[model samples]
Target: MFIKIIKRTMTIILIIIGLLVISYLLFTNFYPNFGGDIANEQKEVYQKSKQYKDGKFHNTKPVPKDLSFPETLKLAYTFFTTNVPNGRPKEDLKTKKVDSINIANYQGEARMFWFGHSSFLLQMDSKTILLDPMLGKVAAPHPLLGANRFNKEFPLAIEKLPAIDAVIFSHDHYDHLDYGTILKIKDKTKHFYVPLGLGTHLKKWGVHPDKITELDWWQNTVLDGLNLICTPAQHFSGRKFNTSQSTLWCSWVIKSKTENIYFSGDSGYATHFKEIGEQYGPFDLALMECGQYNQMWSDIHMMPEETAQAGLDVKAKKIMPIHWAGFKLALHAWTDPINRVQAKAQELNITLITPKLGEEIIVKDTTNNYPKWWEKY
Candidate 1:
């Protein structure tokens, strides 16, 4: 009887293990590729970059050493279990809608529309530019796996939007580079500007090769009389479990004859900010990352205080905090980021603009009309 009982227990354990293996295989296989493999031509381009080494890209400044297996497990455990208050709002966030006519009618004046988080519709120099546009309902591999966007609907539907002159990508992370959003807008988008090794992803998604332009850090291109330069950021990149830092990550400097704009694509507080300021200072506006930060990975994402300082470092005439009020990617309350950064900006006497989602802010308008929209929630 004892022998029979032991045999049954061992058989049950084996069957359970087999089932788990099958489940994992199915999940990975069926899920989107996120991006496909790097082609030989792209690989040749990557080889020319000074940052590419061994088989992956490296940050200008090194990140904290890789976490030990036990440490990584602990971090994962904490992330899965922690419940952050106000991490998500109880109701859909209020947003203003702009029709396509107004967007296309703007003659030569610079205007910007925020779509929450890091996505923005920037019209400057008579060109329409979309930045880090992840317009999907969820910021994850699948809708069921991650947090939903704060708003149920965007200010304008993708189909109704005016033709896009350019779509600028900061990196390949899911929140910033969404597959569903790209598929919906690709036909209408005229050009795509991405970091090194990222064109492969676009190619896999059916974007024509002629429309894609890949840039390494410090590289600049002239697009419709605007100078679009890829700058450095202290961050990592990967869409899947095993491919971290395979592609470069970057901030952007968009300079025209009349205006200079800096978009701080997700970054930790680093000296690169000062370097950028020296190279391209006194920006008309700087969109700095200010949310989804934790101490464990502080090297990759800046704290609120650091975000304010980054604005100063970039010599921005006006600063606007972004990368918050959209998704709950970290442990802090959803409101914590804006609140803290606003306080710091006030202390530093820095000019900060806190626009409501979907609200259009004329680049030349320096007046403070933005309300504390997040406080009511």
Candidate 2:
């Protein structure tokens, strides 16, 4: 009886091991490669497009050596092995509900609050623009793949979001744009601004064609005294299989009559910042990308110091590092990026604002004064 029991136990253990091996192989092979070929092709076409033709891809800034795949994977594995710390969810914060911004009050002023990660609500003049809103809990299509979103939830649910004059999508990356959020907020949006091919995903997700305005790099669009200029970024994009660079990735310069705001959608160290600054700089504010960076993907995401430098490159008066404290896209400690950014910004003497998820930082006409809001967290 003992021998028989041992045989059965061995059989079950073997089965489990076999299943584990199969699952890893499946994810490593099929899952990662699912849309890979299409993405590769899209990249080829994107490279040949006018944006590339105009020398946008030619200029670049020096990046660190660590942003390679091997290093990125190693760091990611190490990050997963270590436990991540927690912070107060934005929902728990006693934030001021932006029910109705007296456009009259802050007239000629600008205000921006990062909901989390790439989700930023900007109020410039009387227009409210939401940038790459990924307010959902999971940054993945399904909840299992991505880490849980850090904030309690966006201060307001997507359906409950106030009227958005424009929804600017940086790319199709899950962390940048949320499908469900768009579905809910679509009706309230008058225009959906995105890069060349990103509109395809928005359309697939139910946003109307007429509502979508696709722009290549250096393209400019005007709406209600706001000039939206799409500039290039060193990055890639895709939502599913076969569509990698079919769309463009970019930063944006939001210039109203008096205020200049730049959103570094997602980028590596690039010379475009200086060019962008020359074209539309001396900006009052720059919502630069500063999180989810690993040495492996350094070509795409900016490191903490790189982010601050980019702010200076663009000649921004104030820098509010966005892209951190929301999702664990990289293995680093949750607060490490912001901590590093603060240090770097201080060294550079660049003004940095660390607002809570829902806390609004109003750029007043007189000057930009931000309290140390992230101190408690």
Candidate 3:
């Protein structure tokens, strides 16, 4: 009877393990949010890239990403359990509604509308382009798996957004490349410019292959007099468990007839900033990454001071902080990024623009002093 009881216990354990394995397989395979799998043909193409190695892509300079078992446990524990004061807002952040009619009929100079975080609606030289437009409420594979947006509404609903001339993606991180937002805007989007290997995600999500242009670092494509160049950024990418660094990541340089802009997608403090500035310096405006960072991952994300210095390294005439004011992805205070970066920018004498979410930011208008919007809370 004792022998039989041991056998029953073993059988129950196996059954539970089998169920968990089945659930994981089904979830990963059926879930569209996990993004595309690398095909054999895609692998052959990836292997040709200088950044590609035995099985994955590498940064221009190697970044140490591995944490020890104990470090991993401690990191996870802090991430899951730490109670951060002001990690999120006391109230929903204020916002202004974006009008579609204004977008269609604007005869103004090059302008931008921020949708919070790294998303931007850029209207320049009669073209409408979206930069990392992850305009969803949650920044995770599933809505239930993440926090909701701090502000209840965006400047414009994704469904009501104007027809897009182009979409630019720096990488495939869920916070930057949202599946739901792509599904809604892909039909209206004319072309997509992404780093090498990133088009795989778009194709799987139903974006036409011809509509997607995959570019390597320093490679460029032109659209109606607008030049879009995929530049280098020190970062990594993945949307699912097994796909980390399976795709290339990048920053972008945009040149119109009268305006030059640089968008730093996400990056650590590195020499790539200096290199990019040498190659494409003196940008009229630059959107710099300024949030979701910690020393544990110092090689992948910049601290506030590094952010300010990066703007100078990129030769930006003026800078604006992004990658914040949208999600509470780190333990820092929600306003910490802006507050810290603002101090550094002032010290460095780098003119930084702090625009309210949904406010119109004109490229050449240096006199309009943006209200310190986050201080009210």
Candidate 4:
């Protein structure tokens, strides 16, 4: 009887384990948001990249992709149990409405519209380009898994946007490369430029392989005389647990005839910034990452102080902070990133642009005072 009881217990345990394994596999594989697997052909492209090795991409400097499982559990416990002061805005963020007619009729010079977080619509040289356009309401692969964006609306609805000449992606992270946004804009976008292996996700998401152009670090392509260079960034990428760093991650240098702009997709502070600055210095503007960061993950995400230094390292004449005011991905207060970045920028005497969502940020105009908008919320 005791033997039989032990057998039954073992059977129950085995069944639960089997069920969990099945659930995990089903969610990671069947869910479209978990993203695409790297094909052998894409592997060939990745193999040639200096950053790729042992079936994965590695940061130029070694860094933890995420905390250990035990640490993650502990962190999760603290995150929910402890109250973070103003971790999210008490009120919905206010934003400007973008006129699609103005966008379609845009002329004269480059202009940018922030859709909060790292999403931006950049029009330059008679072309419309999207930089990390994660315009979705949530950052997770599924709605139930992530926090809602602080803003109730965007500068312009994604469905109402004008024709897009190109879309540039920094990596395949859910927040930066949203699946839903891709579905909405894929047919409208003429071309997609991404780092190596990221094309696999776009291709799987119904973006024709021809429309996707994947570049290795330091590789560059010109779009109607605009130079788009994929440069090194110290970060990791993985939509699913097992696929971390299977794709490349990097910053970008988008240079037009008269303007050079650097978009730091997601990176920690590193020597790569100096190298990028030396290679492509004197940028007219830089959009730097300055949110969803913590000391425990400092090796992967830059502290607010490091963000200002990175701007200087990239030799940006004017800098704007991004990767905040969209979602609360870290333990810090929602406003902490901008405040800290602002303080550092002031001390360093770096010109900082803090534009409201949907406000027009003219590329060459440095004197326009963007209001301290976040303070209002």
User: Which one wins on lDDT?
Assistant: 4
Give the candidate order by descending TM-score.
Answer: 4, 3, 1, 2
lDDT of 4: 0.91
Tens digit of per-residue lDDT, candidate 4, span 1-377: 99999999999999999999999999999989888999777687678778988899998777865578788789888776777889999999988998889898888699899999999999999999999999888988999988899998988889999999999999999889999999999999999999998988988889999999989899999998999999999999989878988999989999988989999999999999999999998899999999999887898899999999999999999999999999988899999999999999999999999988888888889794877878877
The clash count for each model shown is 0, 9, 0, 0
Model 1 sits at a Cα RMSD from the real structure of: 2.2
Q: For candidate 4, what is the TM-score?
A: 0.96
lDDT of 1 by residue, 1-377 (tens): 99999999999999999998887667655666467666566667688898987778898777855677689889878877998888888798988998889887767678899999999999998899899998988888888878788987777777788899999999999889998888988999999999997877888889999999989999999998999999999998888655678888999999989888999999999999999999998898999999999998999999999999999999988899999988989999999999999999999999899988888878777787688989887
The digit string of per-residue lDDT tens for model 2 on 12-115 reads 99999999888766653464222222244445666656654331222243332324557767765886686655532333334445544342244445787668
- Candidate 4: list runs displaced more than 4 Å: 1-7, 65-68
TM-scores for every candidate against the unseen true structure: 0.94, 0.78, 0.95, 0.96
lDDT for position 268 in model 1: 95
Model 4 clash pairs are none
For each candidate in the order shown, give its overall lDDT on alpha carbons: 0.89, 0.74, 0.90, 0.91
Better of 2 and 4 by lDDT: 4
Q: Any runs in candidate 3 off by more than 4 Å, and if so which? A: 1-15, 67-74
Residue 36 of model 4 has an lDDT of 93
The TM-score of predicted model 2 comes to 0.78
In model 2, what lDDT does residue 139 have? 78
Candidate 4 lDDT for residue 256: 89
